[model samples]
Target: MKKLTSRIDKEKLLLAVAAPLLALVAALVVTALVILATGKNPFPAFNDMLSYGSASDSQVYILNKATTYYLAGIAVAIGFRMNLFNIGVDGQYRLAAFLAAVVGGALSLPGIVQIPVIILVAMLVGAVWSAIAGILKVTRGVSEVISTIMLNAIATAIIAYLLQPERLGQLDEAGTLVSTKPLPESSWFFTLDMGPAGQLWGFIVVAVVVGVAYWFTLGRTRFGFDLRAVGQSESAAAASGANVKKMIVTSMIISGAVAGLVGMPTLLNDSHQFDNSFPLGLGFTGIAIALLGRNHPVGVALAALLWGYLERTTGHFEVIGYDKEILGVIQGVIVLCVVIAYELVRRYGLKRQQQRVGAELAAQAAKTDTEVTA
Candidate 1:
């Protein structure tokens, strides 16, 4: 009986883990079909992504890209856990990075003080920006999605204004691209040694720390429980004295603070300045990654790597006369399939759990009846 119970427990665990993997497999099948429809062999495309993405140079790229993606995913996940839709991370990070760059360039402090100051400025800006939506939601019942979307527009205008030559920016040496003044070397991040790959972003450490913190806080903290309770049902959480309004505002601020760090990898390591050409759309991409990872920190890490690897290696398709857009198709398919597959498996697991309890109760009743007869 003990062995059977152990086996059943293991089976349950296996099913829980297998659901996402099965979804990924389904996603591949659908992606392959899409590739076929485009008159390209899916195998070669996938092969190129796998092989090239493992190269030293590609590894560096993947690591850096994943770092930023991981941050963005975490930022989005914070709000997701509270059933909040924070659609303004794009604006939040961009505005934060721009302001940080402006401050870092103007200051002449030591690296220790300067870097922290820059980062703190970014977090403060991001938190304030996100708090606007949260405040509106709690006080006036504004939809966060709408408010955030509008905030994005506002942020864009702010960035554009700040980037003006007469404002916080000037043209590059080439007199074409407009960007903020470059920061002093003290504000720049150190790079990790990677031999032929040259170097990897030091901000990768920050990303790891963020992921670990996210996992620990959510899995072990009382605040996390209240946040989740509110997410599951705001009415029930309020009835249980979870302070639903406070959770909403606190979660949004936390989410935005994390979002503020999303651009640090690129800003401190690659560009050393905030430019108009900085990567955009990472905020929206994070939504798919968060969904694909099921909002688990470890899962988000893997999902980030997968996403970055796909992005880094997809150029191989262009080398072989194939369209690079196929990568997007595969990525989208993966997210969709994973969501559906997980839902199905969740329902199945619930049913199996019910069955197990019923059988155990029935066995207990039969044993009692036999003992009574004896």
Candidate 2:
């Protein structure tokens, strides 16, 4: 019986690691097939990407990109852990970052105070944006997915209005670009010198801090347990005295607040202000990374790094006349494959666990039978 339990535990551990890995391998193979159909030699493209992504300068790019992605993934994962899909992360971050940029840019506070003030504003706005959908879901019986999608559209419109030169922004000397006032030097996130290639964004610290906080919040707190319980089953959680509606609203707000930070790495470090060209769609990428990582913080980090590496490799492909769209295809395939693989592995683990328990019971019964016969 003891041996059977040990075996089952080891098998479960193996399955957890093996499932995603096999899925990744399958995704690569499928991507190769797609490239062949396009009449391109996939190997050379793959080689180029791998080589470029491994370069020192490219590593900094990957790190910066991955930092942003990490925050986004955590934002989505917060929703995922609660079985809530907060798709408006894109809108939430965009609006929050813009507002924060405007506020921070206007402020004349010291470096320490200015940075936190900007972050606070972003979080508040992001939470408010997401809370709109959460409120509708809890109060009006609206689906979060639907509400958040609508909110995203609304957020985009609002951002467009706010971004006009006569509104929260001003036209640059070229009159071709619209951006918020540049942030004060005190408020800008300083970069670290990388000796040669360039300076690494200081917001890497922010990413690490957020990641640690996320893990701590989800793993070490009563609220985390309650969130997971609600996710597992609302009916069960309610029976145990958990407030279902409260959890949903709170989860969405938390998700949104984190989503607010998704743009900070770029905003504070590189752009130093919000602009029309500020990145959009990072929220969607976060969802993919969250799914790819199975919503674990560590897994999410790895997935973000992989995704960033792939993205940074695209410049090489574009330079070499290969279509950059192939990377997108691979990313989509990998995400789909990871989900399927996890489900399959979960079922296999369940079956094996049941078999292990049955085998142990049988052995115990046989021993009893021998004792009675003796």
Best by TM-score: 2
At residue 320, candidate 1 shows an lDDT of 87
Q: For candidate 1, list the clashing residue pairs, or say none.
A: none
The lowest-lDDT stretch of 10 consecutive residues in candidate 1 is 1-10
Q: Against the true structure, candidate 1 has what lDDT?
A: 0.90
TM-score (C-alpha, index-matched) for candidate 1 = 0.96
Write candidate 1's Cα lDDT for 166-249 as tens digits: 999989989999989899998898899889997899999999999999998888999988999999999999998899999999
What C-alpha RMSD separates each model from the true structure?
A: 1.5, 1.2
lDDT of 1 at 348: 87
Off by over 4 Å in 1: 1-8
Give one digit per residue, the lDDT tens place, for model 2 in 97-130: 9999999878899999999999989999999999
lDDT of residue 319 for candidate 2: 75
